[model samples]
Target: MRVVRGREFVADRAWGAEDIASMNGVSTRLHWTDQPYKWHVNDGEEVFVVLDGKVEMFFRENGEEASVTLGVGDIFYASVGTEHVAHPVGEARILVVEKEGSV
Candidate 1:
């Protein structure tokens, strides 16, 4: 089992970006503040596990905008090639996991 503390993970951006290799997959935690970040579309699918605070995930499809609110323990999946933006409603910490060689 892999265990990580949100407070410790948030302390260093480099540490948060460190690659975790396991039989299941590679995982990384991304920490965000209240500032909004740009949307992104990657080649790999991703599962975002909300560890603290709240976040808004916005996506656009067929010229329509869709969004959802996620809080602690909430998991959000970003499909491969799906364009989306994520912003914290407050201070937030999220663990992002993706398959190796997928990103």
Candidate 2:
């Protein structure tokens, strides 16, 4: 059992994460970042939750690019082969659940 203070969490670099659990080839993690992540497609489904600050989530669909601004408590589910990237509005803490060893 554990309690994580999201707002107070810090990482030496962007996207650094604290592993919470791993089960059945899936992992849950808490990530701290202030930088944008590279665009890529996930090999499996991913659950992205904004825990603090804001994020501009960009995704590609049907050969078009679109984006959405996500605030606290917002969730973004990325199905397999979904191409996307995340850019934080500033410093943000995010909780992510996805296949173990996935980038």
Candidate 3:
């Protein structure tokens, strides 16, 4: 069991993360970042959830780039082979669920 005051959480630096859980090959983590993540495709599916603050999610589909703004409570699903990146709108807290070792 774990308890976190998510809204009050802050990262040590850009892209800092707190491990939440890992079971049956799936892992869950809470991340804090003020900078942007590098664009990359996951080896498997991924679930991106915003717990606090705001974020801009950028993705490439069919060689065309697109983006979306995500606020608290928003969820982004990344399927296999989907290339995407995340840019925090200041400082943001995010929850990520993905296969172990998938970045």
TM-score leader? 2
Model 2 vs truth, CA RMSD = 0.7
lDDT winner between candidates 1 and 2: 2
Evaluated against the true structure, the overall lDDT of model 1 is 0.70
TM-scores, all candidates, are 0.74, 0.97, 0.96
Give lDDT tens digits, candidate 1, residues 2-67: 665664455343213435444565645455455556777766888887788788989887778899
Ranking by TM-score: 2, 3, 1
**Would you list the C-alpha lDDT of every candidate in the order shown?**
0.70, 0.95, 0.93
The residue ranges of model 1 lying beyond 4 angstroms of the native Cα positions read 12-25, 30-32, 99-103
lDDT by residue for model 2 over 4-96, one digit each (tens)?
887788999999999888999999999999999999998799999999999999999999999999999999999998999999999999999
lDDT of 3 by residue, 1-103 (tens): 7798877777788888888899999999899899999999998999999999999999999999999999999999999999999999999999999999987
What TM-score number comes out for model 1?
0.74
Better of 1 and 3 by TM-score: 3
**What lDDT is obtained when candidate 3 is compared to the true structure?**
0.93
Highest lDDT scorer: 2
Q: For candidate 3, report its TM-score.
A: 0.96
lDDT of 2 at 99: 96
| Candidate 1 clash pair list | none
